[model samples]
Target chain A: MPQTIQQKFVHQVIGHSATNNRLASKNKIGSGSAPVNIALSKYWGKRDATLNLPTNGSLSISLPGLGTKTQIERLESQNQQTDLVSLNGQRLDQDNAFAKRVSQFLNYFRETPQTFFKVDTENSVPTAAGLASSASGYAALVLALNDLFAWNLDNKSLSLLARLGSGSASRSLFNGFALWHQGQQADGLDSYAEAIDTTWPEFCVGLLEIDVKQKPVSSTQGMQNTVETCALYQAWPQQANQDMQTILQAIKDHDFATLGKTAEHNALTMHATMIATWPPIVYWQPESVEAMHKIWRLREQGVAVYFTMDAGPNLKLLFLETEKPAILQAFKQIKILEPFKS
Target chain B: MPQTIQQKFVHQVIGHSATNNRLASKNKIGSGSAPVNIALSKYWGKRDATLNLPTNGSLSISLPGLGTKTQIERLESQNQQTDLVSLNGQRLDQDNAFAKRVSQFLNYFRETPQTFFKVDTENSVPTAAGLASSASGYAALVLALNDLFAWNLDNKSLSLLARLGSGSASRSLFNGFALWHQGQQADGLDSYAEAIDTTWPEFCVGLLEIDVKQKPVSSTQGMQNTVETCALYQAWPQQANQDMQTILQAIKDHDFATLGKTAEHNALTMHATMIATWPPIVYWQPESVEAMHKIWRLREQGVAVYFTMDAGPNLKLLFLETEKPAILQAFKQIKILEPFKS
Candidate 1:
């Protein structure tokens, strides 16, 4: 076995002179923060579950200003137990799925290495509220590890590594708009992330969080059920690919109307696929439908607000910076949020 | 009101000696027969319920060999108690929706005439099945009346008359292929039916009636619910219009591939709209999805067959005349139909 270019790069980044000596270093910490991403084109079903590769391509915009901050530190004084993870100041058990996913990805590189690592993460967004909190969390871990190891991997390779942990997390690796490449290879090695363009940035997303008490269906399980049973899921790959292409062109052209149309269609298609599944499931609450109708009616009345949801009741209304006030006014008229009397 | 050329022609065909006589003879009855039409571009919602006008246009091909035979008889008998109606050899109560619809349409022309007439109808197709039995029934009544009165009404005029009773029935007024004209009028007077110039004798439809005992949701109520609740219903009208145009062109060019694609997409969109409705009603029986998937899998495996379904559990497999034998043979191999030979 010879040292690969990636391995050499990792050693150099970590200031190590030799491959064997790399593990002997005491500093195993990584990046301090990573941003959350909102999927402009949603990722629904997976082609390979183990690899977390999607059936169709998805594009997302990383919200650099709003996401979780995480820190990974090697614990020399801690017990032989592999890792201790904490989320927003609360210690999480090692058995937790999110923590386990992080540990698993790290274990891939350091075979039989000491598992004594401490993870401290703080989420800026609401947990389990449909706003890609896990995306930011997993992305933070991926970025943290890459920085800690001095792995000089590009966004694409980091995305590939992050995909094994969570599908949407791969999209969070890049800033602005990112597209998850649905690689043709069987091993999913080529399936990664790339920015659509650096210049396009007028896109602004407003989170209208409907704090419903009920928990919605998790995307991972919901999509898996849909893929396994939904008859319409068979048609989604082709339609999603077409939508991705159309949206990519629309994004490149800065056509908000086309982007909005494509996004709305994609969202409907996703929900339709869910209901078409056997033992039909619905993630929508009654309020979700109400909010959607209100937004739609406002749009029909010539408001420039577009709404999208990801496996939950909360709605994210996308609008231009200039149109935000009008959209917020319309939202207030519908009594969607508490009035700010200030 | 001055009689238009269309009204005069209708009067001449209905045996009126003068336009005034035709207008005065309010109690005159006419009977007509038109074939049941299966939609290539399906209509699922109403824009105006009182006029029975559809939200979108639909394309259908009349089944020449099968339909309803209707007879309308004018009566001088003024006894309200004596207006007996019979359908398919069974005495139908005057309060029955179908009978009431007939009476109402007649009353519209008579406007408090001296007498009322009884209508007798016989349906050749299976009633309450996925097939458009009502389309034939209503079309037959309109056509039979036009013939009995010696009214020289064109297919379009008769279709307009029939549309006042049922939206889809209007499309059945023409033979071979037909299009329902969805005019943008509040009164719906301009909406009628027109014949498409394609006589596709080479095309054949094979019925695979998966007899389910449960009564499916009525298209009328289902469509109303969809309009009032389903967010996706808004897109149906636009897509249906596009599909109708595409299918018409496909029929004209004898392009089975394009025709099949358009039909499949239209059907799927209709079903998707249904699923999006609140309370999430599904007209499909469990076996219907299985049957469709079976045929789809076979088609994917090189069988030249496509399936379309209405608001019922039964499936209609559309295939080219030359490929019917092979398609039927493949269908038999799957044992989709049991106890009956393919």
Candidate 2:
């Protein structure tokens, strides 16, 4: 029988020995958690949609307190004919989009036709609000699978598996800074994220939530639309890759100005490509623009703060801890997070 | 003495004969008026700053009854060492930016260093509000100059002179539809706008004034910055040329869908290039974005309306006469005008 591309990829990662070792005991429950990450250098276009390979390298910082926790257990009962999935404390129907996606990803790991699993996941952050819950959700799920089967995969292998679920998930596997390589291989084995080992305690992030509602268009679809229609997007991959290098160096040097400026520019450039697309994808709301102007005004006033936006209207502000008082005064409701601190 | 590039270009347009014929008599007060035009296909970059030549062709529709009127008389009085200028019934100081730009433009027309002019201009529309007042301002000044000198020059020569004042002014010389050709010659003699000749009587324009305040960065500086710093701008020239072609064809075919869609896309693409630049130029105010969302929502609801913006936050909405009532219902503050009707 011909193996599906995903199955082939899973086999390549696990190898024959690990594939044969799907755990002798089905009684164990494995639990894992991961933090949501905001990309400083964004991963925009995809080279391979099926394998979730990005066209450009991306760097990100994980928000320590906000993410997802997942617990996975084998369903050995004879009555369990399909995978059971629950989000938060509520069980999700098989046809629910979230549940269906989880089930589809699980298809790669099934030991046999009758083998089933029950997955329970909880998000500390709002789902599909451009906070990248999927990044942490898939990363946590991959870690749980590693623990449940006693596969004991290293971070690199685990990131590879998580990337199959969501492209940004590769970066979510590591705390603090992570760099996802835009690998050259068509097989996509080389394209995975690794920890950027440097930590600056003064680096601070402020979340300004304009909207927590589900995004109108998913990042997966938005990326495809932008790639297909935006003329200006032809310049994005080169710019994005260069930005990744700049940001990577900035992190090492602990240059907040370079990092903040590059991050803001990268985010705006990504949004520019989206706005240029046909049936233009303007993710910014009125408040988003207002917030941008306010940030610019603050910077003009000598406050060293900058912001980056994902595929939605919310903004993630980057600044040093020294400017926290000014930022707090300006944004009354902002939720500040320190990635370096526990 | 070697002539400046502006003098050479102006001399070429007016010719040696008109240069000698700066009117046998200076007593005549020449008066002229022009309508402000909004570009359907934008002219964003400069090939020649001295002669104000554009890098790409543009198309525009003039809004009649909403522009500038001017009267000019050569300052024969010895007391007037500089050109005397007044705008909207108020005399401007010699050092005022507006008066300085006007006096500087008048420099090309001086018969001698001592020959000065008294220029009085009135704008029914808000000045420097992204309503292209400079377009009408230059066109009116050139028309007044033509009349004052009894140049009897055809519309084409007048357009060439108007272009020397401001790039979009070339299109402002004509009513209804105008196409400003992006010429090939280095001397800039071929770079002039002409009437498109075809008119759709149902063609309507709606003005949504989000802000009438002066733009922070002028279009001239904005274009220069984008050209120098924006990577995405590399793709703009080709796309703009293509969009100009699409819009020109749509105008001829009276294809509202093609025209509206192309114009809106063209404007957004131009703005996208600006946003991609370093120290990004974002002209959209919070209210501007709010207006855009309202327009998009109206379009989604089967209202065939599209909007275009220039270097400021104001929006020029495009639609047909048939959709005017619906548009009026949706946008209570919209100032609607019929181009073909006037």
Candidate 3:
């Protein structure tokens, strides 16, 4: 017979006051928020797998208005062996890596082997659209767990813990420019996040999602292949380090030209590294290349817009909020995006 | 009823009495020695059609003991329309571009009209290899003409004339380390060759002729495509300027590391620019990429070797003569080179 740990905790807390009462009556509730982060400098490879340490450092900006709202509650139930997790009221299996990592972390402090925990998450941001849905999702989970357990850990500590789950998840803990320092330590204990500048609330990043349907190779596998097979991967570390310093300085000086140039070069170099790998891989679809060219042509024609891409086919155009309509109009002219425009 | 204005000069040059005796004897004598030049940086684009000015700068080194030897003898002929041009005693039509250009230049001086030139030529270099046979061929022709006419013009002046025929031909005039500066001026008159550190005789370049049957695309068309469409070409001017400065300094300092790095980067950047052009052309064959990787791997394994490619699939490995056998062995392992072992 499996002794129910939740029943034991409840019995110890309320002295078996209501045996007939549902286990949901004795649950703990918490709410948390997470922000969407845009990577200023992209990270493409991993240096260490066990700790999820990046080969190159990256910078990101955490947006204020867009994020995930998550709520979690631990319930006492008659069902003991079953682990139930729900996202926005939809049931989720416990086998998920993200959920497993979270559950493992929780089990470390609880000192009780609970078979399962239910997590309810609501993502306000678009799911899987390259707007960093995972960033917000993971961030909200970390924050919600922190609130439920009354853990007074700082955001940086939470970020370090979150990094073990997803590399980009750490950036969402802060609402500003975040730099993930890839420390050269064996244990990766020193690797953590630091802020470059507070988020520019007025600055808006316009995303032109081209509605790509195919799933991309996960970042973990893609990066591993590049690191192992890319002839140019060894040279990338020095260049990326130099670029990081220059881009940080540019951001500090508000030098948009330098920032955009660095971003574009870094993106191109990343793609070059991919091509240099054995059995060369390219993230580019025809539309992706065309979109880049269009953006470059528009910029050359005096449009004040610059574009950046993460590990997806969608392009993110950085511009002033006032320039949004014009940028949208230009994107609409592209046939691929025409289907998506209202 | 057209008068032959060149009767006096042609009689004086060939000696009419000797011409009549030669017709009876059927004997021919050829004059002048012209060296073949190989482009080190590789010329692959044209800037001006009329002048045959290159879009980007090219560098070349003269091949010792190889090239075409030709002799031209002026003959007085009564035929006004017939300009007899013979190569090794066979007559060639004067309507071709080669003949037309040469005749046009000669006519610009108004030195002689209605004169038939008997030409005899022999080529010692390997024909149709990526070894710049055309460079040697055209260079020889220009030098032979200059020598025959007693033009009193130096090799630089001769190269300017040669540029009107082919771009790579212009780089062949100098003995070592020549640069073809693509002058920004419209007339391209200022565009000429300059020698960099003519004293570096210790440095030697070896050609590993990976023979292929087909001819590569002409450099003139490649450059036009690159200029019209390559986004990376915009960065080339700045990069090339920096590389030129570094390479010059390295040659002066006798720093092999600097020389090798600059050369490798310049070659790789050139190829990168080529691929970035619209419709994506690649000078690299499977063997070429394999050869590059082999050299790179060898270098990583502590071999002192570097490589550069011209406008074909064949590779040139620049290394000390003593290390040539071992490097060739390494290339053989990759199946890039055939067994050359004795």
Candidate 4:
């Protein structure tokens, strides 16, 4: 009473059809929005520059509406032509630096594989003033391309590609709390971002802009200088790792004070490493200093708010919705700083 | 048969004569000038707060002619009624904080154990502004009193006494390159400052004043806050030790580059620890930030100047005599910063 060959053939057909159904769904053009993520536990150094493997793990959160939207479509032309790219409705010149980086990123797919594509992206975030516009921009590109090319890569695999474009971009794939693990492998096969939670109690990030200009030294280059010359540079990875764990625990335990406190400490430590570098790259403006004191004043008043900054003049204030009114009122007194929601 | 009693008595007579001659030299009322010493490798934390024993060693240089002139005279009466204290020729109240401190210091003198004395001091340095006026101020008082009271206290023992009043004052006991060792003792008998060199090639220090007001939190209290809560606090002692060694070697080797680089790094690391403290005691003002950038800019222009700030708003710039014209010309551009020789 053994099963017949026709029955086995019928079972294989069922499995093949289900697989085809999933792939076919991704056959058409696709678009997605990837929000910009702010690192509460920052990622600074790299273990492998070529593979984009971080030297330490980091934790970040996505500002739900502050991000980029990218639309991508596979071109039918098979002449091995370049991927046509347009940013903010402008056709980027092939010789433009950003366009070249975008094309190079597209080439990373299968290493000279035969599919040309078109990419269009627009951002709702700041460009280079350290709000991490590139993070959200590249994250949107990877997501849209993953959908259009039918590569069927999972979110983690897509994150690996996103990191090649920008390091912080890897964490932008997730919605709420995302952690990019600092993998030890040379190939960075295990280094990727994962979503911790899709939602949390609605939290608002107030951006106190000090300057909106591009820096002379980019964050990547600035970090390279820090790694080479800072005497305290050797201590960053271990401290950041410990900070990541403490922050992660704070998140799990639902302790906002511990979370905010650790976030501020971690951010300051990151800047401390920079300031210790020979010729010490200082990014803080005079107004930024005043703004920080104001935040401290707010905390002194028992306002349950904290602030962090990246490699730029803008200070990001993280607090719950309940504390917004007091924070807003306090910052309003400062003539220089404009507190805003993104 | 080794020696006759007369021979032994002769040896005793010579010793007594030498001691008498040393004390006899201070037959009249005594007055002296002790220049203020600025720490290059700063002393920030204390192991024994009551004794003013630093948690780490420090190195400093004394500014000649920029200090206090203290005059001390023993009273003729047996009243022990009051030790008159005057600053800048104005008699201070008996209940004044400084007068109380001076009386307490006089209590340490064993030579005039029951003697009430009068003390007068005048400061040419910025008091309580981190230019270390107290360092030179207290140092002058101790040196003058040590002479007038005929205590026969060596400079080493006197340094310990100065530390009881102010920590950095210990270094002011020496002329230049004074080092205060952080000793591991409960009573702090072993902690004292020693001279590395009595004199060196004349070097100038440019004082960039940020504010002349007293700080809200004193250095002692600020450091306590750092030790209690800063996550980066533990790494400070080890980093400071290495920096001290490197800087000490640089001083011996006469390598300005190594000295300047390590000094700047060491100072920033200390601030890093403070910045990580809960509620983070930040001592830097906005102009301080600008002054730091200007130093980096000056170095980029091939100048060999370095900066170190203690727990105050003034920044001390150390450079050779050759760089004076160039530094003065550069600082003239900033109106808020008044750079001057100490």
Expressed as tens digits, the lDDT of each residue in B93-127 for candidate 1 is 87887777677666544424554667888887765
Candidate ordering by DockQ (highest first): 2, 4, 1, 3
**Native interface contact recovery, model 1:** 0.04
Question: For candidate 4, what's the RMSD?
Answer: 8.4
Interface RMSD values for all candidates? 10.0, 0.5, 9.0, 2.2
lDDT string for model 2 (A1-342, tens) is 217888888888877666656756343998889999999999999999989999999999999989999999999898999999999999999899999999999999988877899999999996534597899999999999988887878898999999999999999999999999999999889999999999899999999989642246788999999999999999999999999999999999999999999999999999999999998989898889889989998999999999999999999999999999999999998989999987
Q: Candidate 4 lDDT, tens digit per residue, B207-264?
A: 7778543245677789998888766667677777777778777777777778777887
Q: Model 4 over residues A1-342: C-alpha lDDT tens digits?
A: 113332232123224443354335555776767988889999988877666678899999877677899998776677747788888889998898778878767665422356677888898775543577889988888778667655556787778778877889999998778899898766566788898853446466777767543245687888888888766667779878888999888878777889898898888878877776666677876667777877887887899988888887778888877887887797763212211233
Candidate 4 global lDDT: 0.73
Q: How high is the lDDT of residue A89 in model 3?
A: 63
TM-score of chain B of 1: 0.87
Per-model RMSD to reference: 13.1, 1.6, 14.2, 8.4
lDDT of 3 by residue, A212-323 (tens): 6345666778888879865456666666776688878877776766776676666666666565443444445445655666676677677777766777767767665456
TM-score of 2: 0.98
DockQ of 4: 0.34
Q: After superposition, how far is residue A48 of candidate 1 from its true place, in Å?
A: 20
* Candidate 4 or 3, higher TM-score: 4
Q: Which run of 10 residues does model 2 chain A get worst, by summed lDDT?
A: A18-27
**What is the lDDT of every predicted structure here?**
0.69, 0.90, 0.61, 0.73
Q: What share of the true interface contacts does each candidate keep?
A: 0.04, 0.74, 0.00, 0.34
**Model 1, span A1-342: residue lDDT tens:** 214333332333333343344355444677646567777678999888767778999887676566778888776773656778888898888899877866766565552456467788898875644577777777777677666655556677677766766788888776677899888877577788787775454566767666564444678889999888655467677767877888899888888878876776677667787755543445555456556666666776887777666786667777666676777676663212211110
Q: What is the lDDT of residue B169 in candidate 4?
A: 89
